[model samples]
Target: MRWSRHPRCVSLARAELRTALAGWGLLVLEEAAVLVLSELLTNAGQHARVSPGREIETRFRPVGDGVRIEVHDASTVLPEERRPEYDECGGRGLILVDALTDCWGYGERSGPGKMVWAELRAGSG
Candidate 1:
């Protein structure tokens, strides 16, 4: 599904992800999957420097006993992983994503920009 580059899109995307996970009987992965999606979507909305009106896109797929969440944006800039100091107010998105997901990464997508993806394995529990 397509989304605007607004922060509000995060909750909408999470709702869509929950629906998909429920449909696939993968609600067991809901919490982790939602966090992963939120981080990726938030990163895209905040960092992707594309032309005005360009939007972000998302995809949710059942992968084995888990779910794969993807966030796509029109900017080619990739997400950076930062080690923020304790007093920092932000910048830990990818760190949480890495800890929670079985694996995650980003790559060039078709049209423009890149697709940041994460896979959650139900077995993680």
Candidate 2:
């Protein structure tokens, strides 16, 4: 799925993820998947240096008893995990993704962008 750089895109992606997982009978992982998707999409919308009309892409695939979620943005910059103070109101997206998913990381895409991905095992909640 592709989304424009808009704030509502996060919730739109989450809703799509829920529908897809439900269709695949993978609702067991829907909550975590949605949360992770939100973070990735939010990052893309906030940070990706794509052109004005460009959009970000997101993919969901099932991989060996787990679901892999990837968000592709038109920026080559990768995300870094930061240790935010207790009073901080942001910067914890990657941290939550790392703790909730089986594994998560970012990679260079074939084109001019980066893909951030995470995997959630079924029933791993």
Candidate 3:
């Protein structure tokens, strides 16, 4: 779905997650999905290419007992889970996401943009 950077977007995301969790009954999975969404949205708003009249897109899908959260940005440059030194303050978003999720990766979307996705199990799988 499409959403602006406004505060309401966060609420919408949270609600979507809550509904998903209700069906899957996994607290950890829900939290991880929310975290991945927040990280991807923040990254898109901060790092992804943005021109006039552009908005970020996000989609959530359940694959087996795990959920996949995909964030699409207008830029082709994929996000990397780089492990920076302890002194550095930035560049830890993807790393934290990678550490939290069961699996994550980046790939090209239907258009010229890219999709960064994180998958976390709904339970102990």
The candidate maximizing lDDT is: 1
Candidates in order: C-alpha RMSD to true structure:
0.8, 1.1, 2.2
1-125 per-residue lDDT for model 3 (tens digits): 88665656766876787687677665557766787788888887777767755677888878888888888878877787777899998889988887788888889888768988888885554
- Local distance difference test, each candidate: 0.91, 0.89, 0.78
Q: Each prediction's TM-score against the native? A: 0.97, 0.94, 0.84
Top TM-score hit: 1
Residues 15-40 of candidate 1 have per-residue lDDT tens digits of 99999999999888888899889999
lDDT of 2 by residue, 35-106 (tens): 989988998998897798778999998887778999998898889999999999999999999999999998
Error of 3 at 13 (Å): 1.9
Q: Over 4 Å off in model 1, which ranges?
A: none
Q: Which rank order by lDDT, best down to worst? A: 1, 2, 3
Model 2: lDDT of residue 122: 92
* Decoy 1 TM-score against native: 0.97
